[model samples]
Target: MNQTYHVYILASARNGTLYTGVTGDLAQRMWQHRNGKGAKFASKYGVHRLVHAEAFTNVNDAIAREKAIKKWRRAWKLELIERGNPQWLDLYDRLNG
Candidate 1:
């Protein structure tokens, strides 16, 4: 199988809106969002800025993390992103094109 590691969150813009998800292909995922084809929630709400992500050894863990984040309060979710990425720069930039 293709290798991948992701539990991620995206915001519309600085604090505009938020989304939580899991995906193996971070770059492709972000590209889809950038093009407004990622998900209904992302396209409608404009949650396309990859503000946060976590790595896992496998999909199980990534899914668990995604579930955990889904249960978090919006403020807590914001805190998670603020802890590592105060500026919330598009993390996709860290990856090669």
Candidate 2:
């Protein structure tokens, strides 16, 4: 089976605290974040809503994209999210559906 990699962004709310990360299993990672068992930054900042995500075939590319997004200005990050998720809705349920 081919492994899928993802570059994802989580937010506390619309235009709220944001966290960028990379993972092989997006559902599991989002579960951790929502349960406060994910990144310290995410838990501390209450950033659990899945606002943006991009799938990658390469883990290295996912990691690099995550790093780049993390380093981006807040405006750019928000723009990225808004491009796909205009309302900044939690995408967890959609992942399964």
**TM-score, each model?**
0.91, 0.96
Report every candidate's CA lDDT: 0.88, 0.92
Candidate 1 wrongly placed segments (more than 4 Å) = none
- The root-mean-square deviation over C-alpha atoms between each candidate and the true structure, in angstroms, is 1.6, 0.8
Q: Give the per-residue lDDT digits (tens) of candidate 1, residues 1-97.
A: 5577799999988777999989888888889988978888999987888899897878888998899899999999998999999998988888784
lDDT of 2 at 83: 93
Candidate 2 — number of clashing residue pairs? Answer: 0
Error of 2 at 83 (Å): 0.6
Task: Please give the distance, in angstroms, between residue 28's alpha carbon in candidate 1 and its true position after superposition.
Answer: 0.8
Which lDDT value does model 1 have at 94?
86
* Candidate 1: clashing pairs of residues: none
For residues 1-97, what per-residue lDDT tens digits would candidate 2 score against the true structure?
A: 8899999999899989988999999999999988889999999989899999999999999999999988999999999999999988889989999
Q: For residue 83, give model 1's deviation from the true position in Å.
A: 0.4
